[model samples]
Target chain A: MERIPILKLHDLLLVTIQVDMHDRLAMTLQDDLMHQIRRTRARGVLIDISALDLVDSFIGRLIGEIASMARVMDAETVLVGMQPAVAITLVELGLSLGGVRTALNVERGMQLLREGSPEEEASGHASIDH
Target chain B: MPASTIERLQVACEEDLVRVRQRVRTMAAEIGLSLVNQTKIVTAASELARNMLKYGGGGETEFERVERNGLIGLQLTFRDSGPGIENIEMAMTDGYTTGGGMGLGLSGSKRLVNDFAIQSAPGQGTTVTVIRWK
Candidate 1:
């Protein structure tokens, strides 16, 4: 077990997950983050995955699902700091992340969320476009 | 290294996915895989395990270490005796998951690892092998 680190910003919340990106932990974190969104009604979310070495279909789908749930709650979700290899693999595997927003880094994602409109941020639709 | 270092794990149904994944993670780490490699192996294993439980009924997972040309790698084999796939080529195609959820498991898992192989027939079963080098 590891200490899950979460940071709250003005309107965006950042979660730093330290555990290996396995199915159980990913699903648990996704559930907890959604619960937090429903409870706090935060405007946006930034997931810092620079520490994550791998991103698979299950985790990718879970992230997309959480983003969709957040949208229903009127919040936005952005995946930040994806590794180059992970990004390429996700694209190659055809994991459809239709409605989820992504950024090169958390700082950039936060800036995009702060500057972009809800409509733009809400673009993460639940489709397997890939 | 000795063959004793290799670990074999078995699980039944979706309930055992977590345990199977944990076992694979531990073995991957013992092989000295980097964080990135570890993530890829774990995710790939999860995708296969899910398919085994959901589509294949139940199955066994084996974890072993392989060395080639002075390089070490981790190998995982997922085998199930459930209903086999009819069109393996089509199933490998993107967005073609028969069970649902974006249908990204096969293709996604393939891309996450260094080596990927799948064997299946209508009446037999499905066997998937994935490997990643350290």
Candidate 2:
């Protein structure tokens, strides 16, 4: 059983999706991500899909589910490094990953996670900015 | 002019969906489709292949290289012999799924390509054909 490695960096979990994942592998990723969250108690998750050439509806739904699951577990999930084509395909596939926050790249994604919610930063709520 | 066959593959199980995406990408790239175009078609193929396996109980896929009017394109057809769609109108609608999916298989695939055709009847199975021009 090939497994997707879940790396922990401080309070964040980083996942890079590089393969054309099969159904079982997707399920395994979800299960493992959940367990890792419980064990590491990470505050944020960053999923990089830049290398993924194709992501179907099943995978799309699973991503949405992952974000929701992370949210329930007291963590925020941000997806980054999505190619332009993947964004278009996801829209056509009827998946916007509504709850999953997105960034242009891992740099921005990491920034988003390091602090807190982007919404909070946007509304001038969090006054911890230097 | 008849489209030339590029490749063929089996969609017998879940893993076959990955094969479908891989083959679709290879043929799309062979046809010189842009990266965005290749991703769109491959994504569409992925959704359709999964539909065939999960609902149609397995099927086969054929890839074709189409050239017409100085434009090149890639075409794919998926055929299955399991239970067919009971109502295509409803099935084609977004957010309709009989197999616990997000119901993006039909309508979404249609949006990804330039040409789309689907034929199905209850208990007679389903066949979907799609084409994307480069």
Candidate 3:
């Protein structure tokens, strides 16, 4: 019944995970983000997990799935603002979060998304950087 | 040498699982565990609590403040009375799951703590105990 709000910033979708999400809540977030992507036709997704104190394998897998799903929808997903302790714990927990792009913070994540695909930029789409 | 009971919780659903993690974090911090250690213990608690709820059909968690050899530590015990695991070895192996999960709960949680123990059988339920020194 509870939902995490997804904000749309132009061609990007911004999500800040501020609560200690339950399993169903995390699953709902994944479902909601996918639908929003299709509806808004966003080009990128920025997920801020800075507020999350713990990311167990369930949440970790959902994040990976969200990234993979977003890629299939032609959108980039960047995870941002992981705490140093969380990063260490995640590695020890044996979750590499492989194939998920990450940034130090929201600003860097937005910049990474704005940079566009390497091939797209190489083809002179760099001038359209917003 | 002696341990003090800190808190006890009933973990039956997602909300309880969140409470388990938060309580573990708070207790870990109260015992002066470093930030990294607190994160590790809390993550481990999250994994084990979810396993109890999902696979074990809910369970009980007990937090203890333990002192061994003059070192203060936090100890957690999770007990469940649902369907017991048939093969704990396979379950403890990474990427092994009977419940359509990533299967990192048991094995991964073990790695995050200093001491870990588990007991289960085909008909009997499961009990997992872990301790992290500060």
Question: lDDT per prediction?
Answer: 0.78, 0.88, 0.92
lDDT of 3 at A111: 93
Model 2, which residues run further than 4 Å from truth?
Answer: A117-130, B1-3
What is the per-candidate TM-score for chain B? 0.93, 0.95, 0.96
Interface RMSD for every prediction, one decimal? 3.6, 1.0, 0.7
TM-score of candidate 2 on Cα atoms, chains taken together:
0.92
What is the C-alpha lDDT profile of model 1 across B9-128, one tens digit per residue? Answer: 676754577777778778888889876677677878888888888898888888888987788888899999999999988988777877876777787788778999999999799999
Select the stronger candidate by DockQ from 1 and 2. Answer: 2
Instruction: Please tell me which model should have the higher TM-score, number 2 or number 3.
Output: 3
| Per-residue lDDT value at B70 in model 2 | 89
Clashing pairs in 2: none
- Give each model's clash number: 3, 0, 1
Best by TM-score: 3
Q: Which candidate number would show the highest DockQ if scored against the true structure?
A: 3
Mind giving the per-residue lDDT tens digits that candidate 2 earns over B1-134? 76375678999988888888888898899889998899999988988998999999899999999888989999999999989988999999998988788888899899999999999998999999999999
Model 3: residues with Cα > 4 Å off, grouped in runs: A122-129, B1-3
Error of 2 at A14 (Å): 0.8
Candidate 3 per-residue lDDT, tens place, A71-116, comes to 9998899999999999999999999999899999999999998887
